[model samples]
Target: MEYASNASDGTQIAYTVVGSGPPLLMVHGSFLTHTIWRTFGYVKALRGSRQLILIDSRGHGRSDKPHTPDAYAMTNIVGDLTAVLDAVGVSAVDYLGYSFGARAGLALTAATPDRVRSLAVGGGSHGAQAGAFDRLFFPGCADVLEQSGMEGFLEAWSSHRMFPIDSGTRAVFSANDAQAMAAYIRASDADSGLPDEVLQHFTQPSLFYVGSEDRIRLGDTRTAAALVPDSELHIIRGFDHATTMAASEEVLAHLERFWDN
Candidate 1:
């Protein structure tokens, strides 16, 4: 059920596989472990008909922690996922990447031809608009961790207009390593260096799902969906970035629709 993939930078990426059938990779967003999918009932629903490969991205869960942001670059992040697939003997996989995970997946598929058969992305818009909040989102998160530690950071983060942490989610978030997460946040602020050609050249079955109420990422998501060669854009009714997980059933339906094709 558990496996370790050797990252290009020598970091060990830990992952777990649940159920069995067709292989499907599940990548969690930043500040979250692979457990997020399970917490939101994604694994429970999809695993019934497909294998769920849940990854603990470096610096997140059981994966080895790297001190620098270079280690967390989008390329290396994609490498981590490929390494997991290689370890599991899967040549290609359908993917479901959330937020940061979705960015990584997009870059991975773009960079490595035929690596991903299909992709279903949620809550990841590559932050074209998030730049406006960079001051509050990127450095602010790190500052909170430095000045107030996990409790303080979470207190402030849970209050942020963007991050709405519910009671159950908060309980699971208690496992976060504040310092490491802060480092990642700072590092991720850098340009991912993923050329626009990646998306322009993407030729695959893809779905860009975003919440209707998500102010920052909706337009970007719409743009991406329009650009991809074969893609569909779906807006979750009354959902926002933070609350998208609450709409898991609807999200899964969209993913399944993509997968069935």
Candidate 2:
């Protein structure tokens, strides 16, 4: 594990660099750290062929947590990532992000097309309406933070049907700082807009993967994919939003082929 200081914004982001080939950066979803990828053995699986750069976004995992809402802005997040890349001496690299992280990756690609070699966005959508189902599954998420802090928020989140919080993963979740994560979620929800005009011009090679049963953004993912010239969408069967990451072998295979080509 390594720590990089985003001097541009005075934030410290922690990331782990593993593996040994082309530069491949991985970003985890909201409320989870890079450890989710490690726990699932993804780091070891890709380490042989790629240098896995795993990051814990600001306010998540070991990264510095800022309390103010403005601290978690999209520009700040993008700046933090830019600083990490600069600090790591990586001029350009491939990016893989899940959910909130995926959205951040898209923003990064949009901001600096030349810096991203390729992009793979998993289990994410392009806009606010795309996350409408959160009202049904986690109606209290919006209130928990202001009402009782991140711990209260996580308690409500773990009870959701979408998140299968078993003993092991639960422990991982417990280790996370709930207050920081709540700030991140608030920032994400605040800036959940992706304009079609901006995305249509994104010419980088890209892959969009979503679960077949993901009611929230299933249609939006297809729409976003259609706008990107060299992008392809892969829908994983028998998986919902949370399980899609685990059941995405086909998506990973596609990425391997895309990287090789």
Candidate 3:
């Protein structure tokens, strides 16, 4: 079922809960919604062992789309997750996040360690994201969004992909509000990433994974794992950022062992 949680700023975040075990909060990357977890078979693979809490980040999926940059600040993004947790009555949860969501996980765990039991990151990095955005998406992505919106941004993004995005995924991408996305990207790029001191002090068991071919993030992901006192690193051998999550079975097999131990 779908539920709404009001963020501190009054934005209504949409979320869904399923399965019957301990709660596992799942967060998606930019331009994607919680449903990707289902589309990519993560929900099916994990629901038997985990009660899934899937959330749609602000400006994506069924959540309120705000067009101002301040509305998408790291504080507000973190607030949205906490607001949902409060509404759900979950004191702490195991978190699994990808790309944009992975970065948010880092911020959330750093700021509120007691609220997360464990963290799993896919295709994540530990540095300011502006350069990665430029390299992975398109140079001056925010400018492209402002000038031509999602259509123009996707047009440029197509060239960077190893394969064409499926039609269903394309439809989801097209539905997003361009201005809200632009604000999100600008806010994300402006923020400095978590300091090493924070990662060094983190107490949760953490798992950091990046596709071997996702070279832009491999080094940062490795650094994050090395810094965390209780952490493990995994490299999905031949996948790239675009194909990493699609290798759902391989990803989940590793996660099962990580969460089990």
What are the models' TM-scores?
0.90, 0.91, 0.94
Query: How does candidate 3 score on lDDT?
Result: 0.87
Instruction: For model 3, give the RMSD to the true fold.
Output: 1.7
Model 2 lowest lDDT segment of ten: 128-137
Candidate 1: minimum summed lDDT over ten consecutive residues — where? 127-136
Clashes of each: 0, 0, 0
Instruction: Quote the lDDT for 141 in model 2.
Output: 65
**Candidate 3 least-lDDT 10 residues:** 1-10
Better of 1 and 3 by TM-score: 3
lDDT (0 to 1) per candidate: 0.78, 0.78, 0.87
Q: Model 3: per-residue lDDT, tens digit, 117-173?
A: 999999887677765667767788878888898888788778777777678767887
Q: What is the lDDT of residue 104 in candidate 2?
A: 85
Stretches of candidate 1 exceeding 4 Å from the true structure = 127-139, 158-165
lDDT of 1: 0.78
Candidate 1 lDDT over 120-142, as tens digits, reads 88877654322333543444676
